[model samples]
Target: MERLINIDNGGTLTDICVWDGEEFSFTKTLTTPFDLSQCLFDGMAKASTDIFGEEDLPRLLHSTRHIRYSTTQGTNALVERKGPQIGVLTDSPTLAEELRTGDASAELFDDLVGSRVAVIDADRDLEELSQDIVRQVNRLTTDGAARLVIAMADREKERTVKGVLLRKFPRHLLGSVPILFTWEFTPDAVRGRRVWSGIINSFLHPTMERFLYNAEHRLRDHKVKNPLLIYRNDGASSRVAKSVALKTYSSGPRGGLEGTKALSSAYGLEHVLMIDVGGTTTDVGSVKNSTISTDRRGSIRGVPVSFAMSNVHSSGVGGSSVIALRNGVITVGPESVGAAPGPACFGFGGKQATITDVNLLLGVLDPDTYLDGGFSLDAQRSRAVITEVIAGPLGISLEEALIRMEAAYFERMSTSFADDVVDAETTTVAAFGGAGPMSACGAARIAGVRRVLVPRMAAVFSAFGIGFSDIAQTYEANIAGLSANEFAATKTRLRERATRDMFQEGHEIGECRLEWSVVQEDAEGQLLSEDSYSESDPQPSASAHHAMLTLTARFELPHASIPQAEATEKSPAVSSSTRNVRSTAAQVDEVPVFDLDTQKAGAAGAGPAIVEGPYFTARVPQGWKFDVTVAGDLMLTDTIEN
Candidate 1:
């Protein structure tokens, strides 16, 4: 039997799933952020022992056909502030100061205006900037810079600009530099996404590099040779860690979304909502028209940014959300009962009445059979604390107090989705995490969702998504111009770079595609909203002057009627897409895909279905689905299932 293993490191939990042709198993453990591989190996040891026995562990683990992983390494770096001071090289000298601007209403220290790392104008003489580069490098190095990111003003000029940079700082010297270029991170012409990509690379690569290096070394010692395929927020996988941009900070959540989409198909649910509540927060996303939506200008860490991600709303409420009476107001979490002291029921010396305590008080969770009987809970102690802290403060009966607490927590979680998603469509909500199903019913009622699907082994859903991922890598170049041929040439260059990188890593070339993007806007006129007009309320038709790109991968490219610079001159638009356009592959009537049923027959699909593996289940909801058409993507469809 061809065995498949998937591991997902979430904010609060480390999930694992294994498939052995005939059977599947799932496992969940508390995440160890300070040291990630420790948790991975620990979970691996248990799963291996369970399936292969202690004696056959060696061949079983090492000989597994594939081992996939999705981690929060980049998120950790952002939280820990362990990134490098990037020296931005922009096309225009005036754009350098955009980094220093901060939001006025936020308490973020780094968000202060004029707090930019540093900037260098590429328009200035190379000789002058090279000296500045050395000086900046020295200063950043002294100030504990982990990597160096170089993002130019316009990435389309990569070929012409890279030559000048190569002469100034040779690629061999970059071992000491660890440089990231804007074009290299994202070649498309949007200034914001390009800048965001550079910042993520500058800030996260150092930490990821160290953590992955250690993790890989540990795996090597265990004789596992399969290269770890890391997950991206874009729902893709890559092993060329440093070369790509760190846009997929919420990759773990994306995996859960992928799983939900798969499961929804199996249940034949189209429109659905995906809820993943872990230790820290609850992430809610919708699946419409058998696809998940995308956020183009999404914000992360309170930073106004642009990156393609599943439309998700997150709240500071979750399984580990700490419950407390502050100023006599019954409040539950923004703080958590982490793995260390766990909850009041764990008998681990925690005194705080947490969500777990409330769940125990309501009989939603059994003390004797928590975690599939692996861990035991102390119901009496939990109730004692809840009664003393929550019920006593609210002057209500124990049952009433539990009802109030659970209702409030669910209300808070449900409201997050209420404001974002469009209701009145056939929607199904897939719930996971340690406390997901227990709280999902309440949340679903509030969100007006009709049905809820809790898959088998939902606790380790993320790990199952990892097994369904493919071995992949992405390459981009900075290209800015009005010429389609120039854009086409840039695509060719990026593909070549991808090919060279794969060859160096000893990976066989499977399928390759060329993609490009540029800014564009719709020219249609605008229509008035219902509030403005009386009876004939019509949807707005006026297209916003937004950045747009035309991307095609393995698809025929439409000949441009005008040059790229001219195209943008009249039309102010910038797009972020990764569609391949120049491949020899012929366009067919349609493409083939693997759906939930296909995965059960032992094949991964491009449609919605639940992939029930040993350690986890990937619930692929029909409406929130992904495809391989645009190079590859986890796209959200606007078409709601009626």
Candidate 2:
């Protein structure tokens, strides 16, 4: 094992974590939304500077064994409805109508493929069908269709229609809109899963493609030997070309889940509820027995998709999420200011009121020391925005508004945790991200969680989590019939495909640990059963069922050491300094701040205090005890008994 660097790109910040075979070091940079690659390289340069004490990109890149990346931008885009307008074309009218139907997808279907659907007749002559498709494409493009998805009844029909479109609208045609064939993604028999998967993938394609390929090309130019690996929602890393854009959804949160799994194993804890509060969303996930909650067929906004992924819910409320008084009710997000003009406190011309602004005004955040004082936070700007958007409208004092805003934010997070976590008493909440620790105690207490663990690397925790992923990929093919020849043929095809794909990932077929399985799904695409595939009898039961041959190839990598509690005797933690903070509407209190850097392992502290790290801070409010281990792990346990 050598240098493995993990990068988690958020809407507002890009976190970078470097593991040099032994110790871990990390840094972060404000995201450049205008050009994501800019922030990607910016963070890399900072990592290089932090490691070698100088900005040495070449030296850093050459020595690195692997660099894995994950991002929450796709999740943010889907939540904000910020992707390109999409159009859908299908051979079956039933499929086209179902695609536009707003039942399973709700308003998401209307926002993406609504009214932009076209149907073509498969029984028509080839020339006539081609003419119909061309007209539909023209009409859809004219109706502001930025992208297109071709959804048919099956792969056979889908591939046939794709050929017609490619012939008419050749790639050389610069004006031709980009198109996606749904069957190319998955062989799921359900039309809804196949079409929605294509639509979502097409929506996120441009962003992921532009950023990843550009970054990969630049890395190649710099003589970086390994291809850039993308961390997927399936708890593995694969090349950009091999990964699906829809799989990138909520992947950053999945990275946080991986880190939570590590912490659970190290600390010997069970049932961890994760609250990953990033800039735009507070992603909630759960871990039982060191395993993340997962769905065999994942859903996006409740619309089922054709991928198995971790069960993480993205709540709209976050640090930079717009907080306002709507209809006399405090509303938290669904929209965000993002990184460019983050929150009002960021002083990036953002006039929006957000939790960041509230925290700044309440003294929980030091304007001069936030982000390690890298950027100045404008307390006055925060105050002005809050007064205009929240206080003035509600006819309340700014101080009162701040207090209300804090309660609303914590309430939102607590509500999300309540939905995900069943036994709050047994489950320990693990909070991570730049804004995660600020009110972790308050949120957990509200949710009735008795404990919270804020990792030392909480600020860059997601990026650090990506280090646990192994290089892996899966290939599957639908079995045409239950006959022996057909099953053997499908098995041979998937095996050959897996071998070729893994070879591109820099591993030979023999070197990979391969697993073969057969999966059967009902007509509605619900998973029925799975059985290990044996070469002796590759055929499925003669009964009628839709089966698929799946082959998984993985290159297992070494994981970093699991954390162990330090041996030092626990004692009261010494205070580094004190900050004047507004704890209530009536008065300000002197809050003792514990700088973990100056404290020894096993040092303990109690409530009404702040545990401040270089990149993150946690509020140890009343009724909680905070402790640090030798490896810089921070744990907060509720002092209140059950």
Q: Which candidate gets the maximum TM-score versus the true structure?
A: 2
Candidate 1 at 92: error in angstroms?
A: 5.7
Predict model 1's lDDT versus the native: 0.57
lDDT of 2 by residue, 436-546 (tens): 999788888888888899888899988888889988988777774647776777777877888898888999988888887877887777778888876566466634366
State each candidate's clash count: 71, 0
Model 2 regions lying over 4 Å from their true place: 80-85, 103-106, 124-147, 163-175, 391-397, 531-544, 565-568
lDDT by residue (209-258, candidate 1, tens digit) is 77777877877787777666566776666663422436547787777777
Q: How many backbone clashes does candidate 2 have?
A: 0
Q: How far is candidate 2 from the true structure (C-alpha RMSD, Å)?
A: 2.7
The candidate 2 region of ten consecutive residues with least summed lDDT is 535-544
In model 2, what is the error at residue 20, expressed in angstroms?
A: 0.9
Error of 2 at 624 (Å): 1.0
Which residue ranges in model 1 land beyond 4 Å of their true spot? 53-56, 80-97, 100-116, 119-146, 155-177, 240-248, 296-299, 302-307, 395-399, 476-488, 501-507, 510-642
- Superposition error at 409 for model 2 (Å): 1.9
